[model samples]
Target: MSQADKLRQLLAQDKLHVMPCCFDALSAKLIEQAGFDLTFMSGFATSASRIGAPDLGLMSYGEVLDQARNIVEGTSIPLIADGDTGYGNAMNVKRTVAGFAKAGAACVMIEDQLAPKRCGHTPGKAVVSRDEAFDRIRAAVDAREEGADILIMARTDARHDHGLGEAIERAARFKELGADILFVEAPKTREEMIQICRELPGPKMANIVEGGETPELSHQELHNIGYAIAAYPLTLLAAAMKAMCDALAALKDDEPRTHLLSNFGELREKIGFETYYAASERYSTSRRY
Candidate 1:
């Protein structure tokens, strides 16, 4: 089946499908090899990794699209990218939606945070006016061409700014505007989480356990709720950071991997650089033959 059909099938199932967010080709390849059916091109991950900047809407559409294209090329799994406030208002959303779709993103999520927005999980988030956000959603839905299963996910940062009830109401409205998926970003407590699931229904998604601020639940538990999609957006990146810190500390002490023989070969095997080089050499040799 096509990726679109595969995604739709996964959505139709009774439980939430997990989409781990990937920062680069290495992460994407790892997720693919681990048998994840879907992944997200995280704007926050890309911005922080590439430039050491926060996801304060500092990254441009061009920058995001470039990263997204690389991630898509790296894996065959369906990719839902962070389009980041559509890089502007409604018109900009149209362009961004179309451009990202063409760039091989199976889907792109545009949040309702205003331009120059902070990260969704960050404190002090301010959202756009309801009408303004709705207009952006409409433009995003309208922008995609035929034969493009490029889904548009309308994410609301209003859970923090406007309260859960208002966020649910806004999500219902976005559903009416034909958002393929709805992300009510960052509900803090388990009660808040359950309430959002109950209140908002219809092709829904939740950013699972972002930054450990919101209540963390098992995948099975989240799927038991009505959430059709769940993303662990930064877990891999966090683990990677932790490992890097430990490794560096070990280096500083002149004890880097000294006793850590477990999977030393597996570490290089996970990167698979030599395998890629071998494949490239075979192709080059074939051309000469």
Candidate 2:
């Protein structure tokens, strides 16, 4: 089955699907090896990894697509990618959806934030007009109908700028526009999270960002609140960052931080070094010419 179909099947199951955010192919492989059935190519993480920049709409469509392609190639799990603001207007959203789907994304999340969009948890984020936001989602739905089975996840940042009511309304409209999933980003309180799942129609996704504006709820807690999918967008990134920092500090003191790192051999195996060598050996000896 196609990756998109696999994701759809997973969503159809009567349980919450947990997707950890992977910033690159290595991270993607790690997520898969760690037993996750699905992964998310986080825009915020990608910007940080690729350009060492914040998620202030700095990464372009091409950049994100390339990263998505790398992650998709590195793992067998279905991947959901963050398509921030679809990178432009409605037409741009169509192209963005097509590009990401072609790059092997099972689902693409397009938010309603305006141009130069900031991270959902960041302050000073503004959303487009209701009509424009709806147009973007309609465009994404149209793109999906044009032969891409990629699921369309509609995200609304209106919760921070406007209010929970507005965010819920936007998510409802997005659902009407054929969004496969709804994401109301940055709901500060548990009550707001519950209300979002209760009020929003169809399948819902919750983004749990550590230390962000939204409360970090466990998978079971979110599932009980009616969330279909829960994404920990920066979990790996945050952990990796701290590990790298401490390792660097230890290195400066001439103290090998062996305990702070994964075994090199195991890390190579996790990244498919053994499989690669075996494939090379098989192909090298089986050549007919």
What is each predicted model's overall lDDT from 0 to 1?
A: 0.81, 0.90
lDDT of 2 at 111: 89
Indicate the TM-score of model 2. Answer: 0.96
Clashing pairs in 2: none
Worst 10 residues of 1 by lDDT: 280-289
Q: TM per model?
A: 0.90, 0.96
Indicate which candidate wins on lDDT.
Answer: 2
- Summarize candidate 1's per-residue lDDT along 1-289 as a digit string, tens digits: 5555566677777877888889887889899989988998777788888779987888888888888888888778888888888877788989898888788887889888877988777766899899998999889888854345588888998878678888888888888888888888888887887888787767788786555567778888887777788888887888788878888888889885655443767777777755766677758664423
lDDT (Cα) of model 2: 0.90
lDDT per residue for candidate 2 within 1-289, as digits (tens), equals 9899999999999899898999999999898888888998887888999999999988888988999999998888999998999987899999999998899999999989988989877777999999999999999999999987799999999987689999999999999889999999999999999999888888898889989888888888988999988899899999999999999999999997999988999878887877877767768675433
Superposed model 2: Cα runs more than 4 Å off:
285-289
Candidate 1 ranges beyond 4 A from true positions: 145-148, 258-268, 273-289
